[model samples]
Target: MNKETVEVIDRELLTDRDYVSPGLEIIKPDKCFPNMIVEDTSASDWPYLRREIPHNWYVDQRNNYVGFLSRDEANIVYNTALKFRGKRALEIGCWYGWSACHIALAGVELDVIDPLLAKEDIYESVTNSLQCAGVMDLVNLVIGYSPQKVEELAQQLQRKWSFFFIDGSHDAPSPLNDAIICEQLAQTDALILFHDLNSPDVAQGLDYLKQKGWNTMIYQTMQIMGVAWRGNIEPVQHQPDPKVNWNLPEHLPNYSVSNLSADLVKEFLEIVTAIRPYTLLGEARLFSLYSLAKKVCIEDIPGNFVECGSYKGGAAALLAFVIKRYSLRPRLLYACDTFAGMPDPSEVDIYNGIPANLTGFGVGALKAPIAENIKSICKLLNVEDIVVPVKGLFAETLPQYKSEIGNIALLHADGDWYESTMDIFNTLYDSVVPNGLIQVDDYGYWDGCKKALHDFERLRGEQFNLHRIDYTAVWFKKGNFLPN
Candidate 1:
């Protein structure tokens, strides 16, 4: 993964609801768990080894240190791959050496494979980590990609990897190809593991393996990560060993961070600001919106992100940002809007109910972006690749996509009128995945928006886990309790 993709994944993991770490450490050797080496790389010691790496080794930018592997998952990687130490081991990706250091320290004789291995000080930093762990002499840093580099390993190193760690390119064809290449080079009993099993592209790759009759078992999934054993090999899940150390510092539980950093908060706020009235929603609301998107994603909830009234694309941009931040590849943001301004309000949404000063809203008040305008904003934000602009009235456009629609992760209805809001609710509500989210911008402030919400709840005959962010905004999460 490149720096952007890795950072996105890192930030998303930090804000996870289950996360509880000592706030970002001011970088120091003692803070990085200095000399806290793994005593044994045995499968039996996995519970012990996992508690060794710190929550973060957050060094400053001058050294270009970036940590992407989460503490719990890092333990998974170390214990799973390092058990085959002394036999040749292959790692498809090792960005900045967070996980690499631990694996090398376990004496895996690791061969680090990545195209970016020689770029900047990445090579030096990974080596520096190995040197710190005193395993530099046992490892070889390979520079090309796995599929392309697979051919040269036998000629140069003349050793088949008994352990394969596939954390390389997270996209589809690459992961599928990487698995095939590794399978060719591995001994029949090689222990191969893949990271980011929650990712759609990676899942597709896993599906490819199953198609080939490979006996791949998803050994671990607590952190939405998995290990796959190839060539009829069964996956061994680590059962907790009572004799081992299983403590996380009171300040850090499972290596979690309570929240994002100040710099990141400022950046997310600024992005929402740039497209302001396009979104009448404020930072707190937008953050809530973002949190919902991230939560659904982290839970491995199935769906694409959607917005019923995108305006000039502010909220859409926010969703796009979340998807990119988490490296949630292949997630498309459907920014649906009329662009021609709001249609007339229904009798239930008469102008008299809104505030006296804003009664004209029923006459098409918030005229936002045309199709071209939304495109420009998405382009300016560098999210044009995934945030698509859909034009025309919701009643007309939403139905066309219904046949092609998959489940939805988020649905923000800001149509302002009962006819508009309820139209969208009835049409797309069932398309939402279980545990997905829905945000209503005018919930309490506007009677029509409130009316639409109540009607949906009444029809469903169940209440939602609604959270009110402010007087004007409230949101609810769809439960996973599908009735029998």
Candidate 2:
């Protein structure tokens, strides 16, 4: 770990003690500014921060400016600037200069561009905040919109920027455009940070950088923040607050199994609970697989149930159980996998164009035990006779058993990579009976899985009317649903 000392100004000197805003308090700085030591740790590991905002700078602004930056976010901006002190920096949007104040205070030569800064009130407020912070000389306030104004500044200054803070429009194409334009004016080892990554639009901008080979990490701030940079320098990591609800809600309003009997729901819960040790699927996803499998069996859909990527056969056990409990006709559940581990991911298997291996989807990942373990799971579920463990890669086993696997009722696709997912669809899609169900487990989580589904749809010249099973899963009925 490397340590650097940063000089901090007493916050009491920066804010007017008499200034007050409605529904807000103007509190004095708790302590005097001291030279603080910040640890510069290895980029690969999460950085340990003794204090988030060592300076504890606070500004009392009007209600409109209050929500722009939380205390923690303000500290992040200040510390980031401190790390890159003496380097040129650009900020795309500065509502009332809250963040700009922090950046300038860290000794960075800052340029702030925003159309709102053209308005008299906003411009005055920004300048006032900067002047009060004692860093007015560090900032060059530009009154114009980005991309256009950013391009003009790039040409005029003819200087490569080392740090960027993009908090522009949260709309699609706008964020993406800002990133592309700023990238051109950035140094080879520049660090570009973006705010509002919770918005899918803002995330697209970061995705563009990741595709361009920049190292990236997302900070779980209130609105979420993302950082992208080239070369060896790693940005300091922010630990997420435990009090915040970080994970997406599993039970969405759209998820409904009202049609299912209370008894059936109870039975599913029992079965899934029993097999929970063998699967990585959450409760929502497990129920989705169970309900869909039960649907095909109850409706007497012609064909057997097929599961690709049956990791540990937990889900396959559920499929066989549904056939045993619901299907009036005899149907087999074909559980397929290598019984070894995942094959090597192709180039197309990536997360927003970042290589799969870098994101934890590498060769031999998500490996299941040998085929005997799957058989043991089936025997424990009392579906041993109905569940058949087919041990091999999908590319080989799928075609080899295509004859015996004639006419599928439901195809549960859990293969996470591009090639694995595509191989299952290519070989088994034709065997599915009309209106049969195809459930995809990683549609939202893996770019490669989504691409395979899309490419297959285009090849068949038919767009599927996909139904959301959860945040990461979706299913569509074959030959019955189409895009509007």
lDDT of 1 at 54: 30
List ranges where model 1 is wrong by over 4 Å: 1-260, 350-358, 480-484
Q: Write the per-residue lDDT of candidate 1 for residues 1-484, one digit (tens) a residue.
A: 1111111122233423222221111111222333333222232222212324233323324332222555445555654543454467888888766666656644557888888887967787777766655567877888887687876876676768777777788777888888787777878666677766555565555566566656555522222354555542333333222222333323121322112444555566467656654565554467667777777767767788888887777788878877877644468888888876777666666432444235655465566755556776677678888887788788898888865667887888877777778888888999987778888887655567778888987888866655545335667777833233
In Å, residue 73's CA in model 2 sits off its true spot by 28
Model 2 gets an lDDT of: 0.71
- TM-score of each prediction: 0.45, 0.49
Tell me the TM-score of model 2.
0.49
Tens digit of per-residue lDDT, candidate 2, span 290-380: 7788888878999999999888888889889989989989999999988788888888777645787886657887778845567777888
Instruction: Give each model's whole-structure lDDT.
Output: 0.61, 0.71
- Deviation of model 1 at 8, angstroms: 31
